[model samples]
Target: MLVFVTGGVRSGKSDFAERRAISLLKENGSNLHYIATNQVYDKEMQERVKRHQQTREKSGANWIVWEQPRKIDELFSHFKKDDVLLLDCVTTLVSNELFSGWETNSEKWKNVVFQFEIEQNLKCLFSQLAGAPWHVVIVSNEVSYDGFASDEGTKVYKRLLGRLHQHIVLLAKEAIMVECGLPCWKKGGIRT
Candidate 1:
């Protein structure tokens, strides 16, 4: 089963996703896996990562964590049947994929190519997960509400993320948007 969870920053989306994953694990007695996509580039980011790790530890569940900022499709073989995999956030994955070796002076066509590559990579990963028996919970940030940015790069990022969210929701059995620590179901019934 595939689930998509999204919300604004600090909207308790991660906490919700974690609780859902733990619930799935308890029900099936499967191995719990966490695919963290954030790269700590500053002190605040480091603290955020640390806090997430601590939260998982405090849950009293054995979680096998994988720090994968890119090439998520490569991890398909490592997961076993009935395993519960939670990808913390897709925003960081998109940022890492979009900006790794980015050329500020590149032409518009180059940006298109970058977006295509990121989309293809995600598609491949999702395809592999769809065929597997694992219960996948994908978490992402909802940033389109801030309105389209004036900068070209920011615009492209927002557009790409919006497209990705739509695609995932279509594929997911459940799609939820969390606000003020409350989950609003957009697709499928609320599991929790």
Candidate 2:
């Protein structure tokens, strides 16, 4: 089953998803895999990553962690069908791809190559997940409220993330939006 979880920044979406994953792992009797998609770019980010790692370690689950900051679609060869993979935060993965593709371009909206890269990479990862016979949980940020981006690159990134969310939500068996540490189920029930 595919589950999609989204919420504002630091809105407890990751914690909710991890708890659901723990229950699913216990019920399904499957191996737990945490696919961390974030990377530390500075000292502050390094500390944040350290804290997250510590939290995961203290969660009292035997989670096999994989750090895949990019090319997530190519990681299917590393696990089995019975593995329960929880990919925490698609926002960082998409941002990393956006930066990598946008760095070589001039105008953000007019860059066809960057657009193609983002579309292809996201689609590749989603399709790979679709074919995998495992319980998958995807976490993303919901930041498209005001519908206004200050810059062209931010605009492009927001639009890309919105589209990615729509696609994944459709592919998911369950969709949830976390607000202030509470989850409002949008598609399926909260039960595992």
Which structure among the candidates has the greatest TM-score? 1
62-130, model 2: which lDDT tens digit per residue?
Answer: 989988888887778877877889998799988877776444663544587867778777976886786
lDDT of 1 by residue, 3-81 (tens): 8999999999999999989988988847999999998889999999999999999999999999998888788888888
**In lDDT terms, which candidate is top?**
1
lDDT for 172 in candidate 2 is 85
Residue 180 Cα positional deviation in candidate 2, in Å, after optimal superposition: 0.8
Regions of candidate 1 where Cα sits further than 4 Å from its true position: 103-110
Question: Can you list the residue pairs that collide in candidate 2?
Answer: none
Give the count of colliding residue pairs in each prediction: 0, 0
